[model samples]
Target chain A: MDIVVENLVKRYGNVEAVKGISFSVKHGETFGFLGPNGAGKTTTIYILTTILKPTSGRAIVAGYDVVREPHNVRRHIGVVFQDPSLDDNLTGYENLYIHGKLYGLNNTLLKERIAEVLKFVELYEFKDKCVKSYSGGMRRRLEIARAMLHVPRILFLDEPTLGLDPQTRIHIWDYIKRLKDEHGVTIFLTTHYMEEAEILCNRVAIIDRGKIIALGSPDELKSIIGNDIIYVRVDNNIDVCSKLSIDGIQSCKTIDGETIAIQVRKASEAIPEILRYLEKAEIKVKEVSYRRPSLNDVFIHLTGREIRDSGGGFIDIVRMRHRVR
Target chain B: MMESMYIMIYRQLKRFIRAKSRVVGMILNNILWLVFFGLGWAYTLRGPIASALFRGLDYLAFLLPGIFTTSIFQASFMGGISVIWDKQFGFLKEVLVAPTPRSLTILGRAIGDALVSVVNGLIMLSLGFMLTSHLNPLALPIILVIGLMVALGFTSMGIAIASTMRSPEGFQLIVGLLTLPTTLLSGAMFPLSNAPYWMQLAALVLPLTYAVDLIRFHLVGISFLSSVYWWLTPEIELLLLVIISVILIFIAIEMFKRTTIE
Candidate 1:
C-alpha cells in the first residue's frame, strides 16, 4: 500500500470529527472515500495530504509519516481542495508558472510543464486569460491542472466535481482516468455521487458519522445485500409490510403506493415464487422488473436512509395533510 | 533549505510585480498624500517652523522622503490583507501544503511586500525629484535602505497579526486601528521634536518613529540622537526592529502550522 491510515482520529474542540477511521490504498490504484455531508471524508483527505495533523493514530503517505515528515509527504502528494485556490488576479498560465516555481521547477521547464498540463486539462487556448474571466468549470479545470503540475506520486482530490455541470463532471472523470492510466499516479478522491464512485473507483470505503461502514469493490459492496433487486409497482395503496411477509423474499419495502423494491438471494428463482403469492393474495401488480442492486440500495440497506431521497418524504406529508382535509 | 527559500522568494517577488493594480494603487495613494498634505502644509504655513522643517532644502525634499517611507509603511502594513484573503479563498492551503518550510513561506510573503515598498518608495522619490530640484544623491540611498527595513519589519508584523486573524474583516479592523496610531505616533506628517511630551513618548514606541527619524536625519541633517548619544540612534532601533520581526515571523510560522486545515 502507498498510503496507510490506522485508527485515525481528529477532533475539533469538543467534537470528534473523524472518530477512529482506518483505510489503505494500494500503489497506482483509484480509491474512493465515499461518504455523505459531514462524514469526515474531507477531514481524512486533509490528514493524508498533511494539511491537517491527526489528533491521534498515524498516517503514512509514500513511506513518510504525515506528522513527522510533513515536508516529504507534501513533496509526494498533489492536492486539489474542495474550494477554488487559484489566484484570481493572475493569468491561468501565470498561476501554473508560480505553482511550478514553488515546487522547484526551473524557468525553462516550468514553461514547458505549464503548457503540458494546460493541454492535459484542455485549457491551453485560454491559458493567457485571467482566471476571473473563466467560468466555474474552467477554473476547476485550472485548479486540477495546477495540482498535477508537480507530477506527484499521489493525487488527492476532495469532491473534485461538486458544483460542476454533468457534462463537465464527465469530462473531468476522463481526465482523471487518463492521469492514472498514462502516468500511473495513485488517485484518492472523495465524493457523495454514487455513480462517480461506481465508475472510477477500483475499491471504495463507505464512511458515515466518521466511521467506515463498508469497504469493497462496487460489485462486492452490492453483493453485501444480494445480487438482484425486484422492483414492483402496484396500482392501489396497500400495506407493503403485510405483502412482503411471503417466503423466498429476502427483504422488501414500500417505495410508494406504486413502487416497492425487494432484495432476494436469487431473483430468477424468487420472482416466480413471489408473483404466485401476490396473485393468491389478489394483489394487483402493475409493473415488475429484476435488476442488479445499485450502490444506492447498499447505502440504503446499511444507513437506513436513501442515498438520494426522491421527494418521498414530502409526498408522504402531502398525502397525510390531504387525508386530513 | 536555502535553495527552497530562494525559490519561495522568487515566486513571491514574481506575484508582487505582476499585480499592476496594487502598484498603481500604492502610487496613487502616495501622490494623494503629497499633494493634499505635503504641498498643502507648505503653501498654508510659510512660517519658520515649515522653513526650518525643510532647512536649506526645498519643502518637497524634506516631505518627499517622509512620504516615501510612510508609503512603504502603509504598503507593508496592509500587505498581509492578501494573506487573509488567501486563507478565505483557499490559496493558503496550496502554499501551506507545499514542501517549503513554513518560515520560508512567511519570509517570502514579507519579501514580496518589501519589493512593493521599494518600488513605491522609488516612484515617490522620482516624483519628488520632478517636483523639486533638492537632489542629495548620497542621502537618497540611505533613505531607501531605511524605508526597506521599516517596510520589512512592518510586513512581518502584518503577517503575524494575519496568522492569528480568523477572517479578512477581522484583519482589516486590526490593521486600521494599528495604522492610525502608528502613523500619528511616528510623526509621518509633522516633526516630533516639538510635539507634546506624551506624544513623543508614544512616537518613540512605534517602529515608524525610528523610520521617520532615519529619513529626517538623512534629509535635513537633523539627528534625533545627539552626537554624545549617537550610538542610541537607529542602530538600536534597527536591532530591536529586527528582533521583533524575527519573533513575529516565528509566531506566524507556528500559527500557520497549527491553523492549517487537516
Candidate 2:
C-alpha cells in the first residue's frame, strides 16, 4: 500500500469529525472515497496530506508517517483542493513556476514540466493571462496544472468536479484517467458522483458518518446483493412482498412512494410471476422495470437510506420551508 | 535554508514592485507631506529648539527621517492585509500545504511588505534631498540600512498580529487604533523633547522609537541618545530592535503552524 490510515481519529471541539476510520490505498491504483456531504471525506484527505493532524491513530503516506515526517509526505503527494488556490495577481504560467520553485525544481526542468502539464490540462494558450480572468472551468484546469508540476508519486483530488458543467466534468475525468495510465501515479479521490467512481476507480470504500460502510470493487459489491434487480410498482398501496410469488427473489424493498424493489436471479422469470400474481388479484399495476444495481443502490442497501438523503434531512426541511414560504 | 529564504524574499519583492497603485500612493503621500512642510514650517525660527524642532538644522530634514520611519511602520501593518486577503481567496491553504517551511512563508510576506516600505522610504529621502540643499549624500546607504531594519522589525510585529486576526476589516481596525499612538509616541510625527512623561515612557516600549531616534540622529543630528540614557548608543538600540524582531518572527511562525484554513 502506498497510503495506510489506521484508526484515524479527529475531533473539532465537541464534534468528532472522524471516528477511528481505517483504510489503505495500493500503489498504481485509483482508490475512491465515496460519500455524501459532511461524511468526513475532506477530513480524511486533510490527514493523509498532512494538512491537519489527527487527534489519534496513524497515517502513513508514501512510506513516511504523516505526523513525524510531513515534509517527506508532502514531497510525494500532489493535491487539488475542493477550492481553487491560484493567486489572482499572477499569471497561470507564473503560478506553476512558483509552485515548481517551492518543490525545489531546477529552472530548466521546471519550465519543461510547466509546459507539459499546461498542455496536459489544455491550458497552454491561456498561460500568460491573469487567473482572475479565467472562467471557472479554465481556473480548475489551471489548478490541475499547478498540482501536477512536481510529478508527485500520488495525486489527491477532493471533489474534483463538484460544481463543473457536465462537459467540463467529463473532460476533467479524462485528464485524471490519463494521468494514472501514462504516469502510473496512484490516485486517491473523494466524490459524491457515483458514475465517476464506477468508471474510474479500481476499488472504492463507501464512507458515511465518519465510518467505512463497505469496501470493494463495483462488481464485487453489486454481486453481494444479486445479479439483477426487478422493480415492480404495486397498485393500491398493497403489501407486494406477501402477495408476489417469485422464486430466487433475495429481498423486497420500497422506494419513493409506489415502487417496490426486488433482488432476484432472473428478471424475465420474476416479471412473469409478478404479472401473474397481479392478474390473479385483478390489480392494475402502475409500472414495471428491471435494471442492475448501481452504486446508489449499493449505498442505500449499506446505509439503510439514499446516500444524499442520509444527512440531508435538514436540507429537506429547509427546502420544504422555502417552498411553503 | 537561506537560499529558499532568499527565493521567498525575491517573490515578495517582485509582487510589491508590480503593484503600481501602492508605489504611486507612497510617492503621493510623501509629496503631500512635503507640501504641508512648504506651507507651514519651511522657514520659521533660528535657534537650538528651532534647529531641533523646526528649521535651523533642517526641520523638514529632521521630520523627513521620522516620516520615512513611520511610512515603513505603516507598511508593516498594511502587510497584514495580504494575509487577510489570502484567507478570503483560499490561497493561504495552498501555500500552507506546500513543502516550504511555514516560517519562510510568513517571513517572505513580511519581507515583501518591508521591501515596499524600503522603496517608500527611498522616495521620501529623494523628496527631502530635492527640497533641501543641506541633505548629506554620504549618509544615504547608512540611512537605507536603518530603514530596512526598522521595516523588518515592524513587519514582524504586523505578521504576528495578522496570523492571529480572522478578518481584514478587524485587522485594519486594530492597525488604525495602534498606528497613531505608536507613531506619535515614537517621535515619528514630532520630537519627544516636550512630550508628556507618560508619552515618553510609552515610546520606550516600542521598537519604532529607537528606529526614528536613530534615523533622526543621522539626518538632523538631534541626539535622542543623549536625552534618553537607556538607548544612548546606536549599538544598544540596534541590538534591542534585532532581539524584538526575532521574538516576533518566532511568534508569527508559531501562529502559521497552528492555524488551519479550509
Candidate 3:
C-alpha cells in the first residue's frame, strides 16, 4: 500500500471531525474520498500529509509514518491544497521555482523541471504573468505544476476542482489523468463531485459525518444499492409499494409527495410489474423513467438523505473566493 | 537544510521588492521621517539654550540617529505584517508544509526584514546628510551594524506576535501597543535623560533604547545609557541588542510552534 490508516480519529474539542476511519491506497492507484463539505475529507488529508496530527490513530504515507516520520513522508508526497496557497505577487514560474527550491531541488534541476512541468500543464506561455493576473483556472494549473515539481511518489489533491467551470474542470482533469498514466504516480484525491469520483477514481470511500459509510469501485458501490432505479410521478395514495412483492423490485422509496423512487434488480424487468400493480388500483401515472443507479442513489440509499442536503454544511471561503475571482 | 533557508530568504526578498507600492511606500515613509518629522523636532529642540539639553551637538545631528533608529524600529515592527498577510491569504501554508524547520522560516524572514530595514536606514542616512550635513563617512559601518541589530530584534518580536495573532486588526493593535510606547520611551523624540524616572525604567527594558543609544554614540559620539550607567558603552549596547535579537528570535520560534493555521 502507498498509504495506510488504522482507526484514524481527529477531534476538535467536543466535535469529532474524523471518527475511526481505516483505509488504504494501492501503489500507483488513484484513490478518492468522496464526501460533502464538513465530512472530514480535508482533515483526513491533513493528517496524511503530516500537517495535522490524528487524535487517536496513525497513517503511513509512502512507507513512512505520518506522525513519527513526517519529514520522510514529506519528501515523498506532494500536495495541492484546497486553499489559495500560491503567492499572488509572484509569477507562475517563480512560484514553481520557489516550491522546488523548498523541496531541496537544486537550481539546475529546478530550471529543467520548471520548464518541463510548465509545458506539461500547458502554462508555459503564461509563466511570466503574476498569479494575481492569471485567471482562476490558470492559478489552479500552476499549483498542480508546482506540486509535481519534486516528482513525489504520491500526489494528494484536496478538492482539486471544487469551484471550477465545467470546461476548466475538464481541462484540469485531463492533466490529472496524465499524471497517473504518464508518470505512474499514485494519486489520493478528496472531492464532493460524484461524477468526478466515478470518472477519475479507481476506488472511492464514501464518507459522511466523520465516518466512511461505504468503500469500493464505482460499479461495486452502485451495485450495493441496486442495479437500476425506477422513478415515477403518480397521483396516488401513500404506501404505494406495500403489497408489491415482485421478484425484481429490491426496494421502494417515496422521493417526494408525488413521486416514488424504486430500486430494482433490472429496470426493464421490474417497471412492467410495478406498472401493472399500480394500474390494477386505477392509479393515474404522470411520468415514468428508469435508469442505472447513480452514486447519488447509492448515497441516498445508505444515508436516507440525498448527498447535497445532508447539511453540506459550511461554505468554503477559498473556493468561494476563487469563484468570485 | 540550508537550501530551504536560502529559498525562504529569496522568497521574502523577492516578495518585498516585487511589491512596487511597498518599495516606493517604504522609501517615501523614510523620506517623510527624515525631511519632515526629524526637521520639525530639530527646530523645536535646537539653539544655544537647547544646546546643553541636547548634549552639545545640534538637534538635527542628534535627531539623525534617532530617526534612523526609528526607521529600524518601525520597519522591523511592521515587517511581520507580511506574515499575517501570508497566513490570511494562505501563502504561508506553502512555507509551513515544506520540509523546513520552523526556526529557519522565522530566521529567513528575520534576515530579509533586517536587510530591508538596513536599506531603509541607509536611505534615511543619506537624507539625513542632505538635511543636517553631519553624517561622518567613517560611521557608516557602525550605523549599519546597529541598524541590523535593531531590525533583527524588533523583527523577531513582530513575527512572534504575528504568529500568535489571528486577525490583521489584532496584529495591528498589538503591534501598535508594543512598538509605540517602546519607540516613544526609547527617547526617539526627547532625550532619555529628560524623561521621568518611571519612564526611564520603562525605556530601559526596551530594545529600542539600546538601539538608539548605540546609533547615537556612533553617529554623534554621544551616549545616553553609557553616560548614566558605567557598563552601557557602545560595545555593551551592541551586546544587549545581540542578546535581545537572539531571545526574540527564540521566542518567535517558540510561539510559532503553537500556531496551527496551516
Candidate 4:
C-alpha cells in the first residue's frame, strides 16, 4: 500500500471531524475520498498530509507514520489544495523556481525539472507572465505543475476542481489521469463531484458526516444497488408498479406517484418485457428512460438525501478555516 | 537550509523593490517629519534654550537620529505583515509543507526585513545629512553600524508581532498604536530627565529608546537616556538590545511554528 489509515480520528473541541475512519490506497492507484463539501474530506487529507494532527488514530504514507515521521512524508508527497496557493506577484517561472528551492532541489536539477514540468503542463510559453494575469484554469495548471516539480511519490489534491468551470475541470482531470499513467504516482484526491470520482478514481470511499459509509470500486459500488435503473413515467403508474413487482425486477418504487423506478440486472432484457405488459394493460406510458446506476443514486440510496448546493459542509470548512489560524 | 534562507531573502528584496508605493511612502514619511518637526524644533531649541537639555548640540542634528530610528523601526517591524499576506494568499501553507526546517522561513523574513530596513535607514540618514548640513564624516561608519544594528533589532521585533497578527490592517493598527507612544517616550522629541519615575521606567522598556539613544550618542556624542541608571551604560544598552532582538526572533519562530493550515 502507498497510503494507509488505521482508524484515523480528528476532533476540534467536542466535535469529531473524522470518526475513526480506516482505509488504504494501493501504489499508483487513483484513490478518491468522495464526499460533498465538508464531509471530513479536507480534514482527513490534512491529517494524512501532516497539516493537522489526528486525535486518536494514525495514517502512514509511503512507509512512514504521519505523526512520527512527518518530514519524511512531506519530502516524498505533493499536495494541491482546494484554493489557489500561487503568489500572483511572481512570474510562473519564479514561483516554480522558489518551490523547487524549498524542496531542496539542486540548482541544475531544479532548472531542468522546472522546464520539463512547465512544458508538460503547456505553461512554458507563459512562464514569464505574472500569475495575476493567468486565468483560473491556467493558475490551477501552474499550481499542479508546481506540485509535481519535486516528482513526489504521492499527490494529494483537495477538491482540485472546486469552483472551476466544467471545461477547466476537464482540463485538470486530463492531466491527473496522465500523471498516473505516465509516472505511476499514487493520486489521493477529494471531491464532491460524483462524476469526477466515477471517471478518475479506480476505487472510492463514500464519506459522509465524518464516517466512511461505503467503499469500493465504481463498478462494485453500482453493482450493490443493481445493474441498471429503469425509469418509466406512465399515466397509469399504479399499473406499472404492480407489474414490475414480478420476475426479473429487483425492486420497484413509485416516485411522487408519477414515475415507477424499476431496478433490474439486465435493463435491455427487462425493458421490452415491461413494455409488453404495459401495452397489454393499455397503461399508456408518458415517457421512459433507462441507464446504469450512478454514484449519485448510490449516495441517495445510502443517505436518503440528495447532495445539493446548500450542503452544510461548505460553511463549516470556510468558517473554521479563518478561526483556526 | 542555507539555500532556502538565501532564496527567501532574495524573494523579499525582489518584492520590496517592486512595491513602488512602499519606497515612496517611506521617503515621504521621512521628508515630512524632517521638514515639519525637525526644522520646527530647530527654531525653538537654538542657542541658550536649555543648553543642558541637548548638551549644546544643534537641534536638527539632534532630531535626525530620532527620525532615523523611528522610520527604520516602523518599516522593519511593519514589514512582518508579509507573513499575514502569505497566510491569506495560501502561500504559507505551501512553504510549511516543504522539506526544509520551519525556522528558516521565520529567519528569512526577519533577515529580509533587517536588510531592507537598513537601506531605508541609510536613505533617511542621507536625507538627514542633507537637511541638517551637520554631516559628521568621521562618525559615519559607527553611525551606519549602529543604524544597521537598530534596524536588525527592530525588524525582529516587527516579525514577532506580525506572526501572531492574522490581518495586515490589524497588524498596522497595533503597530501604529505602539509607534506613537514609544516615539513620545523615547526622548525623541524632548529630554526624559524631568519626567516622572514611572514614565522613565516605561521608556526604558521600549527597544526604540535604546536605538534612539545609541544613534544619538554616536552622531552627536550625547545621551541622557543612558543616564537613567548609574550602571545603564552605552555598552549595557547595546547588549540589552542585542539580547532582546535574539529573543524576539526566537519568539517569532515559535509563533510561526504554532501557525496552522488555516
Q: Model 2: which residue pairs collide?
A: none
> In model 1, what is the error at residue B65, expressed in angstroms?
2.4
The CAPRI category of model 4 is medium
Candidate 1 regions exceeding 4 Å error are: A227-243, A253-261, A264-291, A308-325, B1-7, B10-18, B49-59, B224-240
- TM-score for chain B of all predictions: 0.87, 0.90, 0.93, 0.93
- Which consecutive 10 residues in model 2 chain A have the weakest lDDT in total? A309-318
lDDT of 3 at B18: 89
True contacts kept of each: 0.64, 0.49, 0.69, 0.66
**Local accuracy of candidate 1 as per-residue lDDT tens digits, B58-96:** 566667766777777877888878778888877788788
Residues A119-210, model 2: lDDT tens digits: 99999999998887998888888888888899899999998888888899899999999999998999999988888888889998989888
How good is the docking of model 3, as DockQ? Answer: 0.75
CA-based DockQ, model 1: 0.48
Instruction: For each candidate in the order shown, give its overall lDDT on alpha carbons.
Output: 0.78, 0.80, 0.84, 0.82
- Ranked candidates (lDDT, high to low): 3, 4, 2, 1
The candidate that achieves the highest TM-score relative to the unseen native structure: 3
For model 2, what is the alpha-carbon lDDT of residue B49?
70
How many Å off is the CA of B178 in candidate 1? 0.8
Q: A86, model 4: CA deviation in Å?
A: 1.7
Residue B32 Cα positional deviation in candidate 2, in Å, after optimal superposition: 2.7
